[model samples]
Target: MILARVEGSVVATKKNAKMTGNKFLLVRPLVIDSPTAKEWKPGTSTLVVTDSLGAGEGEIVLIVQGSSARLAADDKDSPVDAVVIGIVDTVDVGKHILFKAQ
Candidate 1:
């Protein structure tokens, strides 16, 4: 699983039958924070993640990658990589607040 933020959505008319009803989101994978980091950059690749947590654009979400994404939907045959498994309500790291959702 990875921490990512929903950037947009994808609409595909020609997709697997099981994927028809699922919401697909474009996300940017967040870089793991380092205590002594001077620079941090998010991944350039945009991932298509199935939205199970009802996430929206600009919403910070928890994404489950690999075959586990299919398992989360209970469709082992579904072809999916990244999936929005949880909507991040708030991120509290000591005295830092990274992301928050209302």
Candidate 2:
């Protein structure tokens, strides 16, 4: 699993049958400054992930990639390389609280 933030969304009018009903979100991976640091840095890259949990933009989310992403969705055969599995509420790094959803 990877830690990411929902940056935006995507719309594909023409897609595969298995992915017809799914919503896609643009996400940017979050990188922790260090094991003892209480800050997160945005990644340089972004990706589109299937939103399985209805995550909204600007919300921190958990993303599953590769084969695990397909398994997270209802249709295992869907062409999904990444999926938003969970909406993060808080992030505690060691003894420091890095993030807490407001």
Q: Candidate 1: list runs displaced more than 4 Å.
A: 32-41
Clash list (residue pairs), candidate 2: none
lDDT of 1: 0.79
* TM-score of predicted structure 2: 0.93
| The 10-residue segment with the lowest total lDDT in model 2 | 31-40
> Tens digit of lDDT per residue, candidate 2, span 1-102?
999988999999999888888899999999977655878899999999988688999999999998898788866777889988899999987787888899
Candidate 1, residues 1-102: lDDT per residue as tens digits? Answer: 888878899888899887888888899987745674433357777888888677889888888877888788788888887778888888766666665677
- In model 1, the clashing pairs are none
lDDT scores of the candidates, listed in order: 0.79, 0.89
| Stretches of model 2 off by over 4 angstroms after superposition | none
